[model samples]
Target: MTVARRLIPCLDVKNGRVVKGVRFVELRDAGDPVACAAAYDRDGADEITFLDIGATHEARDILLDVVARTADQVFVPLTVGGGIRARSDVDAILRAGADKVSINSAAVKTPELVNEVADAYGRQALVVAIDARRVNPLDPAAGWRVYTHGGRVDTGLDAIAWADEMARRGAGEILLTSMDRDGTGEGYDLALVRAVVERVAVPVIASGGVGTLAHLEEGVRPIARGGGGADAALAATIFHDGHFSLSEAKAYLRARGVPVRATEEGR
Candidate 1:
């Protein structure tokens, strides 16, 4: 049986509140992370990604209380990221009720953490997040670079190469976010998604810049069909702004020939 493409809604939490921004700046409040997560779970989200956009920059720990609260209210897989620097941090988040842990800055800083987490929690529980930006906005061929600290720092590493390394190091999945398209609402950088998708054998989650329901479809369709070929599509703005319900988004994809898991209401 073919695997169903997943639709994940991201909650970029800061100071315990969900926020959205353009290219990771000028963030505006959306709602309480726990409340927003519960709403998505009710509406048919396959999984929810809770990213603490400020924890790494501020050098703080993830809010375990928020993770515990959200997990208690949702049944879908909960992937919590940011401020995860060590295996101990991963242990804390998992114990707090998160199903998976995503590591960004810390993973790039100490690549071994990827291996360590995988060994301790099993590869299925580790997700490596890659925040990538094109070296030249006008030139996709220039390739992409990796960014960390909530897309605030350029690591000067080739994004595709980094993704392969992370996967080889034991990342079960990769959360690939296009920093340039982040919050722009244009759409995902399909080239960037395709590049990373082609490079790594693990599942790639296409994130950033999802304006229309069509964009979500484009992110998950197969590359042979002129799509990004991502195993999953993630978005924040379109969902938070009420552009469409998660059910609507899934329905749209199904209508367009993408196989997605049906919601509880069977829409």
Candidate 2:
């Protein structure tokens, strides 16, 4: 069975407004989430991700109304995360029209949170997000470390090991972001992505650092031959900054031999 590669455009929203930043700082307004999501849906995005980057740090709940408004404007599946602390929070987010709920800080704080949510909502509805940064550029053995609270605090956990654990705990997917490569447009941390993909059974969505459409190709396909590939490629600035429309990305991947679903004329 073949799974068509997914290209998901992410909206790193803060305070109910779409925002963009490099390495999760220096945020600038992009637009309203509802409008942005509607455009992406029309452009043929496979799924939409709205992350409330400020919700966790500010210790507030996710903007459910913002999610509901965005979901109202789009027909595609929506995944939401940030400041999701308990089962009640997950329940509320799903009720707000999110198809899936991504948990990072809360999951890190309580590893069993993955199991808890999976038991209640099924694993398919739970996405465990790993915000990772390379602790040392030189040591591949030390490996990348996981961070929480919007990539601010390092949890001292090995990212690879944590990913394996999350999958074991019944997480349906892993949303892996490379903080070092984020906003730098240096391309995704393919090494880190490959490592996690190799360790986990469920699909892994590669996030951060896409400078070109080719980077998306490299992520959803192999680096060379027989190399690791992410199940999905996610980006914020690329889609939001007038870089490439979702249709163009699918066409680029199709032309490059990556197996992406064809965009219908009306989508």
Candidate 3:
């Protein structure tokens, strides 16, 4: 059975505001996190991912208040990440109304945390986020290197191997972001996506570098057809900037024969 693909709008929050930039730098204000999420929900986003992009780097907790407020406003599933160092952090984020918690730096630092969260909350509630940059940006075949702390620190772990390890440790989903492609709007690193998807049994959400609706379609295209074969496609700049709406994205994907959950408007 073909699992319906999901469309997720990512909110990279810093100091309680949604922001965007190229390769995770020069971030400009995007909008209020809650408003952006509500808008995505209204437009028929299958899910919303709210990442506290600064928390891990700043050595602070994620804005739980914002998480709670966004939770109150959006009906779709919310996945929150950043500064998730311990099980307590995951517990708090979940209590803040996030359906799942995404962990990156902390997961790399302490792999056991993945086990703890999965054991306590079930694998469904644990998402391991991997931010990867190709070792040779000029060569896609060079493989990818993992980076954490909002893509600032190189973890020296092979992206594909790390993803497999996380899935082995009980992560229900892998949120794979191509740091080199992030905010570039070129497209996803389909090679990286395919490598991870081929290695892991868990769902992989391909993120970063989505510039066009065609990119979204390509993200979920079958690997056999030279596409990412991702379970979900996540974008921020395109959706946040009004380049397109979720309804339009869904319509585009459907027109291309991708089975996506219909939005209320599309329905």
Candidate 4:
């Protein structure tokens, strides 16, 4: 049986306010994270991801109180990332009600952390977040280097190789975000999405470059059913700008012959 495609709405929180910007610059407030999440939940969002963009470098905690509050009111699954370093941090977030914990810079800095968390919390509860920017075409060796510290520093690691390794280490899923396409509203980097999807056995949540319904359509095209395409697509700026609702996006995908979540059918 073919599983339906997933639609994820990302909340980039900083100082308790939902913020978003292009290439991680010029941040703008979106709204209250809890309120935005609740709206998405009511609209039939498959899952919601909260990224604490400043927590890591600032040495902050994963705002378990906010996460717990959001989880309490929202019915859908919630994935929390940012500032998750140790197993205790993971425990706090999960205990606060997050369905999964996402680790990026910390996981890259200490590869064993992925295994450690997966061993304790089970693979399904661990998500590896990869922030990648297209390397300068001139520097062929810079292909897909991972970014850290809120995309300020480059780790010099090949994304595909790292993704493969994380999967081998028992990562349940990969959240791949393209810095180049983020907040551009142009479209997702299909090449980047395809590369990561082809290399990892786990599910790939494509982030960045979602401006229109077409971009959403393109994001899930690679996972099409019956050799056709996948169902849902994720967006931040598009949805944040109030261009479309989650239900509307699902209806559009379904009309395009994609298999979206069945519950989203008449809404």
Candidate 5:
């Protein structure tokens, strides 16, 4: 049976406020994290992601209060990332009502964290977000490299290799973001996404460069069709900027032959 593709709205939070940026820079105030989540929930977002982008960059903990608030109101699954370092962090986020926690930098700092958190909460609750950038413009063969600390620190880990390792270590899903395409809205880096998806057994959420509803449709178009065919599509700016609604995007994808959950299913 074909699994229904997911349409997720990502709210990147910094200091308790939702923000959007291009290629991880020049972040602008988007809106309240809680309010944006509630709207996406009502609009039929398959899942809601609240990433505390600055928490790790600033060496602090994610705003648990904001996580709790967003979780209390949003009915769909909620995944919170940023500042997740140890078991206590995961426990706190879960306690705050997040259905899952996404870990990036710490996962790289202590690769064992993947096993630790996945073992404690079950792999289904752990997602490893990989921020990948092309190492060689002339050829993807040089491959994409993983970056940490909100895309600031290059970990020198090969993106595809890291993804494979993360899955083996127990990540239930992979949140793959192409740093080069992020916020650019040109569309997802299919080459980068396909490389990881083809290598991993876990679900991959394709993020960045989603400027139009067509981009969402394109994200999951299937590698066989020359698209990355990510299990989920995540966008921060378009959804937050009101360029499109989750429902409208899903409807568009469904109409275009992408198998997506009916809005009523989430209801």
Candidate 6:
């Protein structure tokens, strides 16, 4: 049986404000996280991702308050990431109502951390966030490389290979974001999404470059057909700016023959 593809709306929080931009640079304030999350939930978003883009190297808290407030208001799943470096940090976020905690730089720096969290919180609760950018556009073999520290620092690791290793190490899911497509609204990097999806057995959530319904359809259909595509597609700017509601996005995908949840069918 084919499973329905997921649609996720991402909120990049910095100083408690939802922000987004291209290449993880030039971030612009979108709105308050809690309010934005509530809106997405009401719009029938399958899940929502809250990334504390500024919590690293500064704030030690994992935006528990934001998570708590959002959980109180939203009915769907919530995945929290950014500044999740320690086991306690993961615990705090989960306790505050996050369905999953995504780890990036910490997981890259200490691969064992993925296993540790998976063992303590269960595999389904752990997600490895991979922020990747095309460092060498001229080289077709250059491939997407993982970036850490809120997409500011390059890890020099191949994104596809890293995704495979993370899955082997017990990561339940992969939130793969393309720095090049992020906030550009041009569309997701289908090539990059295909690369990671083909290499990993776990679910892959494609992020960045979802400017229109067509982009979302492109990302979700490929994955629903098989690993050679995207299982879910996430957006920040498009959803944040109110270009279209989550319900509209899902309807568009379903009409295009993508296997997406019909939660928005009535609405």
Ranking by lDDT: 1, 3, 5, 2, 6, 4
Per-residue lDDT tens digits for candidate 4, residues 1-267, read 378888898888876667753222122333678877877787778999888765553324436767988989998889989888788888888998999999998898899999999999899999898888888734434568789887899898988899899999989988887788887887876677777787777888888788888788888875433121323356777766666877888888789866778564454
Model 1 misplacement above 4 A: 20-30, 56-62
Please write out the lDDT profile of model 3 over residues 33-141, one tens digit for every residue. 7777776787799999987866453323437878889889888899998777787888888998899999988898999999999999999999999999999989878
Candidate 6 residue pairs in backbone clash: 222-229, 223-229, 223-230
Instruction: Summing lDDT over every window of 10 consecutive residues in candidate 3, give the lowest-scoring window.
Output: 21-30
lDDT leader: 1
TM-score of 2: 0.90
Off by over 4 Å in 5: 20-30, 56-62, 265-267
Best candidate (score: TM-score) = 1
| TM-score of each model, in listed order | 0.92, 0.90, 0.91, 0.87, 0.91, 0.88
Q: What is the lDDT of residue 162 in candidate 6?
A: 96
> Please, what are the lDDT tens digits per residue for candidate 1 over residues 24-119?
212233367787787788789999999886655332343788889988889999999977878888998899999999999999889999999899
Better of 3 and 4 by lDDT: 3
What digit string (tens of lDDT, one per residue) describes model 6 on residues 33-58? 77777767767789999888775544
- What digit string (tens of lDDT, one per residue) describes model 2 on residues 1-267? 389889999887787776763221122334677777777787888999988766453423437887887778788889998778888889988998899999998898888889999999899999999999998876656699999876789899999999999999989999999998899887888889999998999999999899999889888886456434999999988877776788999999888778887768522
Of 1 and 2, the candidate ahead on TM-score is: 1
Ten residues in a row with the worst lDDT in model 5?
A: 21-30
Worst 10 residues of 4 by lDDT: 21-30
* Clash pairs, model 2 backbone: none
TM-score of 4: 0.87
Query: RMSD to the native, candidate 6?
Result: 4.4
Off by over 4 Å in 3: 20-30, 56-62
Q: What number of clashing residue pairs does each candidate have, in the order they appear?
A: 0, 0, 0, 2, 0, 3
Model 2 Cα shift for residue 101 (angstroms): 0.5
